[model samples]
Target: MVNRWASGSLAQRGQANRLSHGAAIMPVLLIVGGGLFGSQAAAYARSRGIEARVFDASLEGAASPAAAGLFKEAWAGKRLAEHYRRAIPVLDRLYGIRGVTLKNDDGEDESFQCVPPSAILEKKPVLAKVTAVGDGWLETESQRHEGWVYIAAGIWCQQFLPELAISGKAGAAFAFPGEQPGTIHAIAPGRQAIAFVRDPGFTHFSDGTAERDYAQEHEQATLSRAAALGLTDTPVMRFWGYRPYTPGGPVFRRIGERTWLATGGRKMGTIVGASFACRLVENELRA
Candidate 1:
């Protein structure tokens, strides 16, 4: 009664200040690498109203761009059945999967593809190399950032968590001048080689090759398979990259209070990335 202004105006100001402070301290997701895992995480974070930024050095031998973007539930097998199920919805929502039939000598193979555009991330990556990371912060050569750090550095993730036994299976896919009809031809007895249009204006070919030591012989073998599909002409481009493999399976784990790590996509980078993205955004961060 004696001092109404002091109680009323001061109380409103205090509430506003607290709200502002809370907003200021809200965690941003700091993603390292701009490949499938990092990009998917950034996209999911934005959908959940969490700020996110990607840092990538755009190092050669990243597997995401080279991926055929083809997948089927049967390919996941028993171990990754749950991952396949969880990944489909997120992939459909973010990138829009489409059904396609892969014609082969035996018959036809039914599968789905999600060919994300070249610019899949919301914004361009920071284009900086992340030199170090901790519980809630990361540093580039020139600056430091504080946030919920996520390391999705693909094969290079071993540099951060040295205890984890990570290895790379390197392979190459070739691209011809024009789009070719979709087909899958037998490369080996049970394995199939795919020759189809993945990127627009180019025909793509890849035999299921994951070699620890990629050599000219491996390249020749891939080319021989491509020739079997009548892709004999000199290729306009070759996509070479390393797929990361872990001992058990794909990894998605929290390493620190505000830090997480994920890798080991292997041949299933697209599905694994999307599934981990959903888990990180919908479960871990939100919880």
Candidate 2:
């Protein structure tokens, strides 16, 4: 049976794990979609002494590159919460995550870097910014690590796995204006304090016609919400992309006896689904 739910690390463990214990080389697993999920999958597999190749059209509007790079924890629903638990530690170990927050008591903004496992395992705050002293104030340090830029990560995977395939498409999907770095806030709807990403327009896209009009509508709605929240300065960026969804949720479909279809990441493709898919495929191949 193949285990499901997805999305690792490097260094002293050896950046490349294609061969270990003088074992035979592993077979290459072909993963489609170069978004966050695919990149994470490839990276995870490489670290486990498995060879994996990722392919993406890299078309304009592809979700990964256009993504705001928000890494958030899921608090609702057992399935998603579990995915978050599995992914967070591994992602943090491999790539240090930068913490950002506009919420503070000193009326000052702050940022910090962290490795999740170290923070989690040691039960200590690695780079936490203290907002209060005594009692509850110390709890913030236990949480750390979350974020990604899929496109650049895919490129990095190629460096680690030289034979990895990452063919660029002809047309670029989205356009990023201005050279200055910008901030994109992740807001979780309702009572949850965690900021998860959910674009109703993209998540509910019906066909090709939707994207042509999505920008204007998305901007207007975002602005309205921002205004209501008194966050008028929040920048809204729009892009078009395609995402595949399966009713059974993401799974590893065995194609014949050798190949497998690792997809169905849906909205959580980048952070949760992608990582899970990669690991699932890696384990199957090893078995």
Candidate whose lDDT is highest = 1
C-alpha-based local distance difference test score of model 2: 0.38
lDDT of 2 by residue, 24-88 (tens): 44445444445666566666766776655544444445545434344456322465676666766
- After the best TM-score superposition of candidate 2, give how far the Cα of residue 186 lies from its true spot, in angstroms: 9.9
Identify the runs in model 1 with alpha carbons over 4 angstroms from their true place.
1-25, 107-109, 116-123, 188-190
Which structure among the candidates has the greatest TM-score?
A: 1
**Tens digits of per-residue lDDT for model 1, 1-287:** 01011232333333432454465345679999999999999998898899999999889998888788888887788988989999998988877886666787877665656554353543689999998877677788899777778999999987777777899999999998888788987667646798888878988898889999999999999999898888989999998999999999999989876689999999888889989999998888888
lDDT of each structure? 0.82, 0.38
lDDT for 219 in candidate 1 is 96
- TM-score each candidate: 0.89, 0.49
